[model samples]
Target: MSIRPADSTSNPPPGSTSEATSEATSEATSEATSEATSEATSEATSEVSSEVSSEVSSEVSSEVSSEVSSEVSSEVSSEVSSNPTPNLDIREWIRIGTLEEIDKNGPMVVKGIVVFQHEGSLYAVENRCPHMGFPLHLGSVCDGVLTCHWHHARFDVCSGGTLDPWADDVPAHAIAVQNGIVYANPRPKQPKNLDWHLHRLREGLEQNLSLIIAKSVVALVNAGVAPARIAEVGIDFGTSERSAGWGPGLTILAANLNVIAKLDTYGQILALVQGLVHVARDSAGRPKRHMLQPLPATEFGTPRLQEWYRRSVEVRDIDGAERVLLTVLGGDASDADVADMMIVAVTDHFYLDGGHTLDFHNKAFEALAAIRPELRPQVLSSLIPGLGNPTRSEELQNWQTPVDLVSPLFAAFRELENQLGRISPATLASGTSDSPTDRNASSIDGSASSIEGSASIMPSQTSPLLTDRQTRTDAEKIVDVLLGDDPGVIVETLTALLTSGVDPVHLSGLVALAAAKRIVHFHTQNDFGDWIAVLHTFTNAHAVHERLKQSQNPLATRAIYHVAMRIYRDRFLNIPSAALPKSDAADRAGYSTDLRQLLALTDKQQQVAEAATWVAHYIDTGQPMGPLWNTLGHLLLREDAEFHSFQMLEAAIKEHEDWEKSTRSIAKDAMRTLVLAATRYLAAHAPTARELPQVARIAWRLARGEKLFAE
Candidate 1:
C-alpha cells in the first residue's frame, strides 16, 4: 500500500511517513508516469510489426508497474523507519514500527514533547525547560541525562529530576510502549490548589523558611486569597508562636495591611512576605502558646454584647471575649459599634503593660477602618491574640498600697471619658478663637519687666539676665534643688526665675528638664511608672507656651507651673540625679560634629547626656538653637520610632517653631529645657540606629545655617 502524506491538522498516526517521505513519493510517481507513457508508445509500434508484440507489451506494462510500485514502497519504508512515534499519547500504547526507526532519529519531538530512546527503553518529557521555558528539543541527551543548551540545567530524562537547584524539575510524562510505539500522558502527576498552598504557607511560617513563605504567599494570592486573610495567618502565627506574648512584629503586620492593599500583586505579596519573615524570625525558638479560637455566632444587642465582651476580657477569658466580639462583627455591627466595644474592653484594664495594650487596640481599630469593610473580618480576627496577651497592672501589683495608684488612675480615666463632650473648646484652652492680630498684639515685647504688671503670673523681682553661663548654672542648681528632700525649694527657685522676668515658658522648660533628669537618675527600689506622667507634663508645657504666645494667658502658665510642681513632688522616689556632664565651649561647627558623633555612639545613655550638654553649651555660647532643634528633628525621623517617641518629638518640633519666631529669653530657656528633655527621652527609648547617615547629612546642613524644614 502507498504511504499517505502526514496531515498537519490532525495528529499523525503511529508508523506514518514524514513530510520528506511524501515529497519523495510524489517525485517517484511523476517519473513512473513518464516511463509508462514511453513504454506504451513503444509497445504500440511493436504491435504493428508482430502478433507476439501485443503479449510482450502487456508483460512489459505489468513488470514496469510492479517495479515502480516496489521502488516507491521501499523509499517510503526507509523514510518511515527514520522516525518513530511522531505523535504519541501516554494514555494509549503506540505502534511506531521497529526499534530501528527510533534509533535512526535518536530523539524526536512528538506532539510538542521530546521522546528519547535509551538502552532499549523509551522516555518522554515536556519539551520546555522548567527554568525559563526554553525548548528541550534543542538540548542534548547523553547517558540518560538531558542538559539544556541555553543554561546547562541538567535533568535526568528517565526520572525528570533537576541537578541544579535553581532549575526546577522538568515534568515527566507517564510513558508506555507497545509493539515498538511510544505514548505519554502530558498531565502532571499531582495538581496543586489553594488548600495545598495555604498549608504550605503555614508550614513555611512554622519552619521560618523565607523562600517557602514567599512562594506560598504568591500562590495563595494568585489563587484568590484575600490580603487580609494572608495577614491573619502571619498575625496568628506570630502571636501564638511566641511565649512572651505578642510583639512589635504582629503590630507591624497589622499596620501594613492597609498599605499592602494599595500595592500591585507582586508588591503585595512581597510586603506580606516581609511581614511574615519578621513574625517568624521574632517567634523562632520562643515558647508557643495556644491561640484563642472564635466562638459560635450569637444574636445579641450592641449594649449587651459590649458588656459581655468587657466582662470576658476582664476575667481573661479572651477566647470567649473574642468570640463575642467576632459574633457581633459577624452580624450587622457598624465600625463604630466595633470600636466602642473594643474601646470598652481595652479601657476596662488601666495601664495594661505600660499602656501599650491600649495604644495597640486603638491602632488596630484605626488600621481596620482603613481597609474595605469586606476585608475586615480576618484582620479583626487576628487581633484576638493580642487582646488576650496583656498582663494587667492589678495582676502584678498590690492595689491596697498608697503608691499603687491603680484605683485612682482608673477613676480618673473614667472621669475623663465621662467629661469628654461636656467640656467646650473655650473652657479647655480659654482663648482658642483669638485672631492673628489679637495674638500678635498680645505677644510680650520685654515691656513688662516690672513684677507689679504681671504680679499674679510672675513673682515681684527683676528676672536675672539668662546669659549662657547663668542659664547652665541655674539649670544645675534647679536639678540640685529638685534632688533635695524639700519640694518647696524646687517651686521657690522656679518661681523666683519666673518673677525675675524669666519667661514662665523658659521656667517650664527648666522645670521639665529637671523632672526628666530626676526620672533618669532615680535609682530607686520602686520602679515608679509615674515618670511617664511627669515627662508628658513637661512636654505639654510647650503646648501651653505656644497657646500663650499668640494670646497672653496666665492660666496656661499657672497650669504648667502646677504640673511642674507635681513632677517635683514625684521626684522624691529616692532616685539620685545623674551627674550632668561639664561642657567645653565649642563653636557652631565643632558642636555640630559633636552632636553627629554622639548620635553614632552605641552607648545611648551617654549619648543622651552628651546631647544635653552640647545643647546647653550651644545656648550658653549664644548660638541659634534652631539648628540644634532641627538636628533633633532629623534624629527622630531616622527610624520607625515608637508612638510615644513621636509624640515627644512632635512637641519638641512645635516648641522649636515657637522659639524660632520669638527671641524672648524665656523662649530660649524653654527651648533649651525642651531640647534636654527630648534628648533624655530619646536616649531612654533609643530609636533604631538605621538612620545614622541621614542624621549626619542633616547635622552638616544645620551647621552651614541651611533651613532644615523650610516648607
Candidate 2:
C-alpha cells in the first residue's frame, strides 16, 4: 500500500485527474512502506550474524511495517476522502505533488509552502514574500530568480537570497524527493534574533536605509521587543549621530510619544519608521560616535546618584552618566525625583544648543514614561550619547550674551513655579482640589462678577458706538499702533478697546495677532532664546482668549495686556509683514480648502501670512470657528514637535469653553494668532510635504460632517 502524508488535500494536482491522484496516492504509500522495511532489514542484518539476524530482521520488519502501515493508511484515507482535514503539525513534510505535477502547475502551494520545479530540481520556500507579504507562488520565476509581482522584489529560487535590498531574504525550506514525489517542510525558518534585528535597525539609521529600517522594526516588534526600546534606539542614534545636535526629528519623536503609543501595532511601527528616517537623513554623512562603556555599578542614594549623573553629563562621560541614570531609575526613585534631576541637569546651562538640549530632555522624559519600567534602563542607555555630546559649545551667542537674559528667565520661571505650587497648568485651570484657590468659592464669585460686568456691556444694551464694523476697524488700528514706535499709545488703545465694551475676547484676539506679528517681523540675530519667548507670549494670549469665552476673568485681560505690551516693546525689531493678498470670507468648506492650499506653499513667510489672513477672514465672516480649530488641531497634532508647539497645543486644548458661544471678533483674532503660530512652526520644522494630502483629507472630512476630534 502507498502512504500519503496527513494534510494532503483531496484536490487533484494541476493537469491531473481524480484517477491519477488516487494512483499517485497509492503509489506513495507502497513506496514509503517498502523503503522503511528495506532499510530496517538492511540495518538488522548488518548488525548481526545471519542465524541471529534472521530473527532480528523478522522483528524489525514487522515493527517497521506496522508503524509505516498505520501512517500510510491514515494519510491515504485523508487524501482520498471527499473532505481532507489539514495537518496541524506544520513541521511534518506533506506530500504536495510529484515533480512533474509541480512543473505543470508552475508552483504548488501546500500548507503555506511554495513548491516549484526549476531545471528538474525541486525547491520550496515560504509562500509570503519578505518585502510586503505578497504571495510568492503567483510571482514569475526566470533564470533562477523569483520576482514578486507587486513591488518586483526579486529573489533567487534556490537560495532565497533577495536581489532587491528592500525585500530582505525569504525563508526557504528543505525539499525531500522520494519516489518521484515532492515533499516540502512546511515549517518556515526562524527569523533573525533580537540582537541581529537591532543591529539592522542601527545600520538602517546610520545609512538612512528605509527598507532595512522597516524590516528591522517589524522583526523586532514581532519578536516581542518593546516598542519603547525600538523607539529609543532610533532616538539615540538620530540625536548622537547628527552633527547639528538635536533637531526636529528628536523633537518630533518626543512630541508624538503618547500618540505613537496609542496607535495600533502597525501604526506604532510606521511612526517610529518616519521618526528614524528623519534622524537618519539629518545625521547622514555626519561623524559617527562610538558607544561608551558604563562604570562599575555602585550603591548610591538618589541624591548621590543624581549628582553623579549630572557630573558625568557635565564631563561628557556618556557611559558614566547613563549608568548613573539607570541606577537611579532601577532603584525606588519616584518619577518626580527623576524628573527633577533631569530638569536640573538640562537647565544648568542656558539655551543649551538653541534650546534643543532642554527640549530633548523634556521629550525624553515624556517618551520614557511611555516605556515599561523594566525596559527604561535600556532606553536611558541609548539616550546618553546624545545627552553628553550636545552641540552647546557651537552656540557662541548663548555663551557670549551681552545681556544676562538667562538668569532673569530662570528666576522668572522659579517664581512662577513657586506661585503655581505642585499643581500642573492643566489642574490649575480645571478647579481641581490641587488648585491653590477654593474652586467653588472662586467659581461663584468669578461668575457673579462676570455676569454683573457683562450686564453693563451686554450686546443688546451697548450703544452702536463700536459696531461690528467699527470694532473690526478699531482692531486693525490696534495692529497699526502695535507696529508703531509709540508703546504707550498701543497700550492705551488696547485698554480703551477692552473698556469701551468692545468684546474683551475680540480685543485680546487683536493683541494676540500683534504678538504673532512681532514673531513674524522679528529679525534679530539673537540665539533661540528671546525669539521663542515671543512665540510663547502669542500662544499664551491665544489661550487666554479661549478661557475668556467661558468666564470673563480679569486675569485674561491682564494676560492679553502683557502680551500686547511685549509686542510693542519688540516693535523696533519688527520687519515688515509679508505683503500677501487679503482672503475673502468663505464658507467653512471653502476656508478648509484654502487652509490646506496655504499649507502646501513652499514659502514659509507667504504661507504664514496667507494662513493668518484666511483665518482672520473666516472669523470676520462670523462662521463657526470650531471646525477650523479642529482642522488646525489635526495639523498641529501631526507635525508640530517642538517644545513651543507642545505649549501652544496644550494651551489650545485647555480652554474648556463652548466655542459656539465665543464672540466672533475675539474668535477670529485668537484663531488667526494660533494659525500663525502653527504656520511659523511649519516654516521652521519643514515636515514632509507628503503629509499635506493627508492633512487636506482630514480637513475635507471635517467639512463633510465627520467628527473634528476622534474619540
Candidate 3:
C-alpha cells in the first residue's frame, strides 16, 4: 500500500477515515488455490487521493456487479434444499488488511472475510452480518466483542457466539498464519452433508484429473507419442486392470537412480509416508476414493470410438512409488532438481494443501543457504516478496504459524550445511561454532575436516559490538539497507531469527523501522494500514515499557513516554477516512482513554491542563470523554490554583466551604476555553453559582493530592 503525503501543517478532520482503508493488492492472488476476483467495499474508496478519485470510483462500481451476482445466487440457492457443506474449498488467500487495518475497535473486511488482529494473531469470520447478512467486516471490535456495523448485532470472536438478542451465530473460519501471511481455511465440511460432499468431490475430481492429464500429456510428448495415440492408450488403460498400472504407476517408475538416493535421505519421505498412511486408512478402515482409484474416469475417444472405465487400484506402499520415480530420474538429473521433481511428484499423490511437503521446503532452504552467502537472500526473496519493509511483520508472524509444520525443514538445511562443511557440529548442536582457519577451503567441498580447530569463527550470540545500543543500531542499519535494496532481506533475516528462537521484539523493532518509512503497506496497494498496525503495536510495547520503567528506573519513563505519545498522536489523529465510525458508547469511551493515556506523557501539571482542556471539549461537544475529569480537576485545584491555602481557610471553615472552593478553582477556570463555551452555558443553568462553588470545594477535599488526570 502506498502512503499519501499528508499536509505537514494541517490535521485532517476528526472522525475522518482518510487513511483507514488503504488501497491493498491491486490484484488478489490466492495462497492455497488459483486467484479469485476480490470484492472491494465503499470503505476502500475512503482512502483515494483526490487525483485518483474517479478511477477508484469506477473500480468500486465494477465491484457492485459481483455483489449483485452473489445476491442473486443467494436468493436462488435459498430456495434449494439446505446444504451444510461448503461449495468451494481452498478459495484464494486474500491480502487482508495489515494488523493496523482494523482499528482497536474497528472491523476490517477483505474479500468476504471479517478480520481483526489483536496481540499478534488474527481472527476472521464470514463477513455476512449474522443478524441480517449485512457485511460484518464493516463492524467494530469493542471490549473483545465484534459489533456488526449494520443492525448493531454482536458476536464474540473467541467463540463465534452471537451476542445480539435477535440473532443466531453464523459460521466462522479457522485462521492460520505463517511468516506474516494470513490464511483462512474454512471449517471442514461434515461427512453427513451430502450436498457439500458432492461439491468437494466435484472440485477434487476436477483438480486431480487436470493434474493427471497435464502430467500424462507431458510424459507422452517426451516419449515422442502423438496426442491421439496417447488418448487411445489411455482409453485402453481405463478398462484393462493391467493397463491401469501404466498411468500413475508408470509415472512414478520414471525416476532415475541418483534421484532415488536423494529421496532416501530426504526427511520429506517420512512426512509423505505418514500422510499417505493416514489418507489410505479412512475412518472406517477403508481406503479413501482418491487413494484407491488412481483415475476416477477415463473417456477414451471421439465420435468414432468411445470407452469409459473407473476402478480402484490394489494396495502398495507409497514408498514403492517413490523408489521407482527416483530410480528412473536419478542418473539424469542433479540432486537439487531431481529432489525438486520428487517433491512435486510426492506432493501430487499425497493431496497436500500447499502442493509442497515440509522436507522439500527444508531442502530448498538448505540448498539456498549452502550456495554463496550473498545469493541466499535473493532465494529467500522469492519465498517472501515484501521482506525488508517491516510492515509485513504480521506476514512474518503469519509465516511463523506455519513453522511448526516446517520446523523439520531447518534440520534439512542444517544437514545440508553439515555436508557442505559450512557448519561445524558444535554450531549445529549448540549454536556455538569454532572458526576454521581456511575459510575458503572450509566451505568448498562435501567435507572439510582439515581446519577443525584452526578456523576463527564467531559464536552466534557474540557480535563484535560492545553495547546493546550499538548492536541494535548496526542491525537496524543492515535491515534498512537490505529493505531498501533487496526484497528478501527482511524475510531471510527474520526466518533465521525465528529458527533460532530469538525474541520477536527485536524483529518487531526492525519491522517498526520499515513501517516508520512506509515500506511495507499490506492494507492496500495505496494505503498505510499495515504501517499503522505495526506502529501501534510497537508504541503499545513502548508504553508498557515506560510504565514498567517508572517503577524500576524512573529515569527512563520520560523518554519512553515521549516516544509513545508521538506514535499515539500520529495513529489517532491520522486515522484514514475509510475507517468506520465509532458507534458504541463504551468504545468511544475507550478512545477517550487512549487519548488521556497519550496526554499523560506530559508532566503532572501539563497533564492536568490537558485533561481539563479535554473535559471541557467533551462536555461542550457531547463527546463521551473518559471518566478522569474529577481527579484531574481536584489536582488542579490543590496544586495549581492553591485554593486550599487561603485567608479563605476561614471561609473554608464554613459548612459550604469545600463546594465554594471547588467551584471557584475548577469551574471558573474551565469556562475560559473557547471550546467550553457551550459547557459554561449549560452549567450556568444547572446550579446557582453559590451552590456550585460549595460542591467543587467538597470534591477537592475528597480527591487525594495525586494527579487525577492520568487515565
- Give the top-scoring candidate (TM-score): 2
Model 2 per-residue lDDT tens digits across residues 1-711 = 223432233322322333433443334445653453244334322332232235643553443333222232222222223222233221134556765676566789865568766654556777767665567888988888989897899988876878886567776765544455665543333324466678878987777766677666655655557777887777667645665455667655555454453355554555566566667777788776544444456666787787777666656776677667777877777876766555445434333444445445545555665555554555445556567656532123322233222222222323333443532442222233422222322322322123222221112232222334464345556666666654434444554455445676666555656666666555434343555766655555554454344333332344444455446445545544433224563343265445455445423432444455565565565656555555454445445244466444433333223222556454544444444455444444434344523432332332222332333
Candidate 3 ranges beyond 4 A from true positions: 1-75, 80-197, 200-443, 446-475, 481-501, 504-711
- Which window of 10 residues has the lowest lDDT sum in candidate 3? 305-314
List residue ranges in candidate 2 displaced over 4 A: 1-98, 104-114, 126-129, 132-165, 171-208, 215-248, 259-270, 279-333, 378-573, 578-606, 613-672, 683-711
Ranking by TM-score: 2, 1, 3
Per-model lDDT: 0.49, 0.51, 0.29
- Write the residue-wise lDDT of candidate 3 on 164-210 in tens digits: 53454544554532122343433311221323322322322223332
C-alpha TM-scores of all predictions: 0.40, 0.51, 0.18
Question: Could you give candidate 1's per-residue lDDT for residues 1-711 as a string of tens digits?
Answer: 122111212232222233322222222234532432233334332332242245643543343233212232222222223232234221222222333455676666654456777654566676767554567877888887899987899998876778874455665654432222343433322223456556766777787766556655655665567888787677656655676445656555554464453345544554566557667777888778653444555556766776677667656676787678777877776766776556545544433554455445533454454455654555555556666657554334332222322222322222332334332332222122422111222332112231223222222332232333365335555545544544334444544454445665555555545554554553324453544655555444433443334323232344343344445445654355554434473343256545565456424533555566666676676765555554554455444354455446545555555556765555555456556666666665555654422332332332222333432
Winner of 2 and 3 under lDDT: 2
